[model samples]
Target chain A: VPGDSLSYPEDLCPPDNFNMVSTWIYRSSFPKKKNFSFLKKLGLKSILTLILEDYPDQNMKFLKENNVTLFQFGIAGNKEPFVQIPDDKISAALAVLLDRRNHPILIHCNKGKHRTGCLIGCLRKLQQWSHTSIFDEYRRFSHPKSRSMDQQFIELFDGREAWKVIDPKWI
Target chain B: VPGDSLSYPEDLCPPDNFNMVSTWIYRSSFPKKKNFSFLKKLGLKSILTLILEDYPDQNMKFLKENNVTLFQFGIAGNKEPFVQIPDDKISAALAVLLDRRNHPILIHCNKGKHRTGCLIGCLRKLQQWSHTSIFDEYRRFSHPKSRSMDQQFIELFDGREAWKVIDPKWI
Candidate 1:
């Protein structure tokens, strides 16, 4: 009954790489104007974006109208020896993700490949999923452009640190 | 809090290609004994399998012990001009999927690629997802082994037929 009342006269165009991460968590590439109707169907309470750039005006308007809060934990994509994703930022994002108040949230980055994948991978760790399963999911979304640096980041992430901030009841 | 009480003494190994399809629907490759502990954490009410072979004794025992109902709609894999997946079986599976009583159901096949992908693709159509978005998801799980025949089956499979049998409230 969640989405039954919503009228769908035509097909919904979900953002690229869109997929459900868990019970109320979703992941996708950066959403566009065309994807707004589809996003509305999710009845999202919040959107956690991993992009560093300022949000576009159109998206801001949509969020405002829908009363969906935005939480941005910007981290640059892991780019080899020069740039590395900050662990603290990811941990903070995990803390936000662990709260049920933010249920029905959508997590996204530019391509939803590296930054978002890394966050979901870390979340999978908290869920006690084996590294093999976590990496399998990571690579599934990353596909042709999977990054080894991102995988290493997930491997090295400390779930204990995440545990410190998250509510046990929410986990 | 849905999974908060599930104890995770050790890392859990989910079946290959396991993912949430919708609110209460999950898709994965055939479950193995090693993945039992992880499946237990899902609190599944039932499992719907698409393989033509008889259910394995071990799996049957797991379902019985866990009180998970099994719904098998056996259909041959779409193997080009020779073997075609029957439309009626997929339609029947969709009918099961659209019912809320079968909530938290796991759908699987041998590889969780072709036949499973085809079935999920049709479900996406019922949800009013665009064909481009549908095929993107199909290819993501199928990956290197994506089959055009299965994609065609999804494209040609009529959602109107599925709508006939499904409850309006569940949609």
Candidate 2:
């Protein structure tokens, strides 16, 4: 039914590429106030922010007012070849995400690419997803600008450590 | 960058509404052979089919040859209020889904709506997702024909039993 003919909402900062991961978790780009309102309407409980830089006070204030917790993981430069995402940060963020109470959680970065993509790639690794599938999903977002180091990170992510501590119910 | 202006691929049945849920799992409508090839290209290792009826021999054969496993859960009717999805079946399908070996999996129905939406809804419940977010994702797929029963089922889904048994490493 979702042919190429239908039009989407025109609101700026509308949750970009928003999709559900097992009903509780969501993947999308950064949310503006309007998008935050939309998230509130959707009953979002927490946000896993991957913006390497820039954290607006107003947005943080709005999130607090809305009762939405923010989990910030700032790793600069989505495309700077040397800016590698730290494994411990990813592990820590995922630890917060492990609690079922964090359901309806959103994982996002500035453009919902690069950093977000890498995080998802690692998650896929936890899920035991193949490298090809991981890369395809990454390319779907980053497209012409997808970086190789991020893919390498995902390809080599070892989830055994994360698994030993994370709740098993998520799989 | 992913404004509404960009165009998706031209391949027919190329995983409509296709997106990575956790790097491993993908969500989309049913696929044709061409789509199958596309999926194969992406290294899809398995499929979680939710179509109630109509499993063509060609598709099955193709999957077999391509080495992609198929997990079929046929629930009759998409919008027929009389045709309700069985809870046990959902539990069973989820059981298959729980295995990390099933990563790079695709969950699909004819239109990727109704039944698929219900399953996703229940999964959200497992993740402790809010009804608002669950329904929003459902509507994104079902659009004009989004059914009330499906929404009702999701709103009332009891994930306790399923949660008690499924693996947690997946989240």
Best by DockQ: 1
Write candidate 2's Cα lDDT for B55-130 as tens digits: 7998889788888888988887544646667777887777667568887788888777777778877766654455
Count backbone clashes in candidate 2. 9
Best by TM-score: 1
> Which residue runs of candidate 2 sit more than 4 Å off their true CA positions?
A1-17, A20-55, A58-171, B1-13, B78-81, B164-171
Which of the CAPRI classes, incorrect, acceptable, medium or high, describes model 1? Answer: medium
Individual DockQ of the candidates? 0.53, 0.06
Query: Could you give the C-alpha RMSD of every candidate to the true structure, in order shown?
Result: 2.7, 13.0
Q: Which lDDT tens digits does candidate 1 get at residues A20-132?
A: 99999999999999999999999999999999999999999999999999999988889988899888899899988878898889999999999999999999988889999
Instruction: Give the CA lDDT, 0 to 100, for residue B110 in model 1.
Output: 94
- Would candidate 2 be rated incorrect, acceptable, medium or high by CAPRI criteria? incorrect
| Residue ranges of candidate 1 with Cα displaced over 4 Å | A1-9, A169-171, B1-9, B169-171
Number of the predicted model whose lDDT against the real structure is largest: 1
**TM per prediction:** 0.95, 0.53
